[model samples]
Target: MRQYWVAPVGPFHTADGTAYATSITLTDVSPAPQITLPANMLEIGSEIELEASGFFSNTATPTLLLGFYLGGVAGVALAASTAVTTTTAAVAWPFQLRYRGVVRSIGAAGSIVGQGRLYLPTSLVASTTRFIPETAALRTVAIDTTVAKTVTVGAQWGTSSASNTLTCQDLSVRLVT
Candidate 1:
């Protein structure tokens, strides 16, 4: 049997066009753009899909790091992207990311295997958006499926600057089985 659940919360985003500034440490792009998965909602073969889009601008070619977390910003780490150096400076570039995770087990020691890709622009040209695949060899992480889990995405800049800012415009989560 198969089932699906569209998240009831959002398509969430930052409020009032507020953009999150990057620091040397990772931080949530938008605290409000998170989804909570109810306890026992996942089983073997169950899958989760997360889609997000945002715009970023930098004054310097800083190294950017992105991560997915199972709790809040400081919670259990699910996956992290390899450091990507910004190709351009002072240009507002738009990016999109999609992540998929499948439950491999269900329990306090449950696990999920996942992967994702980022569509990042190298320039203002439409065709310049490059597909940056997650190069992690193994993204299997232990999770507690018996309790509710909040998922969020975060980012950091290797070199912090006031001009190095990012704003998440949209985020959606879906459940499938």
Candidate 2:
């Protein structure tokens, strides 16, 4: 199976070009064109940025989960709101992640801001968590292409709330080493 993923716009180069092969093409569009990257193309020690925007309006409080995933697992917690009101929620997160053999280093930060109706009993809260292996044996290992992790942004409505729409307007990731 081909693992399709997103990438940044640039003439990027790695230490050894052989390990960093990409298929980049440009097409004419409106103001800006589009660029596509090969499937499952990611490198360690790369900096990534992701942003998601949408509107959420509801009559009652709702639970929402927003965060980033690496290696097919939730590595970083960008935002988590157990109780949220009707509002426009947006997530802007940036982080640097790298794995060297059995060790890893990461520095990340993000925010979940909202704007909702005034004078209503509304509340919005957010928290973050670092990605840690659940299994003890998995801790001392290397992240290869098969297990090569990619960056992902996500938001979920924890409950079946009425009159609630969380439209994810944009979800983008960029590599910056």
Candidate 3:
């Protein structure tokens, strides 16, 4: 190959005076966290958040929420009594979500509900960003295990946190990790 033209995105020659075209172009190369929250389990006053490549990225507080639901009844949960915490840039945050004043499951086969935001973290992206969503659909935003370890989402939204609408896209929420 003499050279490669990745459209207007790329075009270059190899050190050997020859080059090849890129097989593909990848974006949003951020880490994605694998959650391991169990369902129908009573609040144990313990919480955790984890992060890895291709999991959880650019998550926002008050945007990403975790809850355990049973049938139509859902109980608001905190990462250890914490409701909201700040998410930095490509980094992470650790905090506890409180569930003291939340309801417990009154049904079977409960599921953990979560939310994803499209906002940028103030700590990392402090340049005052527009916070616009690339897609009008759901965003892949959530808390990272690094900065926010524990937190409560129920109380943060208010007393009727259960009534809050839990929406997200490209999200895999389940009882098992």
TM-score against native, each model: 0.84, 0.39, 0.19
TM-score leaderboard ranking:
1, 2, 3
Q: What is the lDDT of residue 120 in candidate 2?
A: 16
* Candidate 3 residue lDDT tens string, 66-129: 3321111122222211233434232432212111112222123222222222232345334222
lDDT of 1 by residue, 137-163 (tens): 457888999998787777888887888
Q: Per lDDT, what order, best first?
A: 1, 2, 3
Clashing pairs in 2: 71-149
The collision pairs in model 1 are none
| Model with the higher lDDT, candidate 2 or 3 | 2
- Per-candidate RMSD vs. true structure? 2.8, 14.9, 19.8
| Candidate 2 TM-score versus the reference | 0.39
Between candidates 1 and 3, the TM-score winner: 1
**Between candidates 2 and 3, which one is better according to TM-score?**
2
- How much does candidate 1 score in TM-score? 0.84
